[model samples]
Target: MSGDRGAVELEGVTKRFGSMVAVDSVNLSVKPGEFLSLLGPSGCGKTTTLRMLAGFEQPDSGFIRISGEYVQGVPPYKRDVNTVFQHYALFPHMTVAENVAYGLRQKGVPKSEIAAKVAEALDMVQMSKLAERKPRQMSGGQQQRVAVARALVNRPSVLLLDEPLGALDRKLREEMQIELKLLQSRLGITFIFVTHDQEEAMSMSDRIAIMLDGHIEQLGEPETVYEHPSSAFVAGFIGRNNFWQGVATEHGIRADDGTEFVASRPEEDVPNGQPALAAVRPECINLSAERPADSNNVTAGVVAGVSHFGDVLQYVVSVKDRDLLVLTPRAHAARFQQDDNVFCHWSADDVYLFSARQADIVMTDGDEEIHDN
Candidate 1:
């Protein structure tokens, strides 16, 4: 490992499994101490990419570099990286301190050095008090911390986390997210996290590479990818969106239902008259009793359902043949009720227009469901 900084680079990397192409030609550059996430649904090749980076799986083509050195044939133990899997994978019989000291002991470090390093690692994760407790006696969160400590004991330049928080309950997972982020910031080590949860990626990643069908569909900061998606798939996957299939127009799109979308800036070009999709995020659509003067982006609907989520309220409005999801601040959400007539309107700036290349992936059979951020 280069002691200066942990910089990783993947150039035109490709991986295959028999007849299946798990990861397409992918290029990524991660700066030292940066937190980057490989985010996508199951079977999108996120885990494969992470495995390749950890040296557990070699790429079929292209090359990988770690800390400025090409690591094409380097084995997992030889690479300057360590991985924490979804399962804690701690030895059940080993105490917390013993578990953390296993790696150093395997490498034949001095007993005095191993003890000091084990204590430091346990202290880093606030698990020092549980150093004498076996994995079977500790809580899930504590076991997770031990797993992290074991990885950190090696002091790898880059840490690969594959859904490390996936096993915990929602609340504990959220708490771990904060701790892990703070830990990364404190250590200044490069972290490459992989997960299928969009919200997790958005909250933890400095930049996210959203993969789909073995290739990265888009790569950007959370806000950039959410507000200005490169493709229809990204717009739908990053967050909840109400999509309207339509034909591209000079300004925006004309929905098949006759609704017009005049976007100030379209995310993609569709050669005017080509099939396209126009999307608006749930929070962008405002519900009102009176229709706005601007007719281009206004439509009528009936409130089909309402769901309260602490400070936010989500509404399912039935419009013609489809249901549109809208989110509003709870303080401002009392005006509408189920079966009430309402007008849904949005600003052109909030509209996102894209070519319908990935419409099949975005559009589902039922109404789009809303998930809390």
Candidate 2:
């Protein structure tokens, strides 16, 4: 792939399947050599957008350009990009080396040079020792590495991955995440990764484009999105949060449970007395056995549940018939038992206030556990 590549541009991109619009009028610009992730829940059009970029699907009413060249009607084989899907898709009969060399052979590359390129690609993914193994003989992670090698073997300027780590176990997935990130940095190639996994997107991407209902919801660095979410959906989707439904008050918001909150840095402006939703991250909340003094953000609750997650402790505090989740470091964990009285307090700076206009899109605790699909 050429190192001197230009930006990838999508202008008014839209795609539809029957009555449903898979992708809306979306516009995006990806910097050269940038790692950008398309993140959202299932049916949010993340995969469709990536397919459009890979030349597997065409936009109904938009234009796409790769490396400064318009690629209308271009076939996947001809596009200057490669796609790696969740499934390995490798031929069961073919060895890893043969699978990695398939594209070169199909394109009629000189046999003299094919082996060298295959070796280079396999080495890039650290799969040289398994080059002779078939897909069925290797673990999911190994097969995934070979699949990635096959894509990289083509030397495309851009790589599009659709939840490439979704098939692995937690530990293996995390290991591959680190490996893929390091590989991308070494190559400096443009990577447009599509995943529903928030942690995956946050850890591997330079910037994340959170999509919702076929449209781009928010685009920014992971920290920016997590600290200052643009909408209730963005705040709820990017990380764990406790939400309160209420009406906007003069200073903050009045919850349906009769608790009021003040957000020192509200991302959006809402008229006074209007309905709104407030969110705060679990780690931002401080839990204690004693009531906090002189704080409007403090609420009385009882410990409903406790979960230990290695280095962190998660608490479910029941306040006013609502179960609010709170996270604390294991070292700083408060010894509160189920049914024990507790106090939850947070600073105004840690609160996120959003207009109730997005309540329908924002997820709640009752919603299915949000994961990258």
Clashes in each model (backbone N, CA, C under 3 Å)? 0, 2
Residue 352 C-alpha lDDT in model 2: 84
Question: How do the predictions measure up, each by TM-score?
Answer: 0.96, 0.96
What is candidate 2's lDDT per residue for 307-336, written digit by digit as tens?
A: 999999889999886788999999994677
Error of 2 at 177 (Å): 0.4
Residue 110 C-alpha lDDT in model 2: 99
Q: Number of clashes in model 2?
A: 2
- Residue pairs clashing, model 2: 196-372, 197-372
User: How accurate locally, in lDDT, is each candidate?
Assistant: 0.90, 0.90
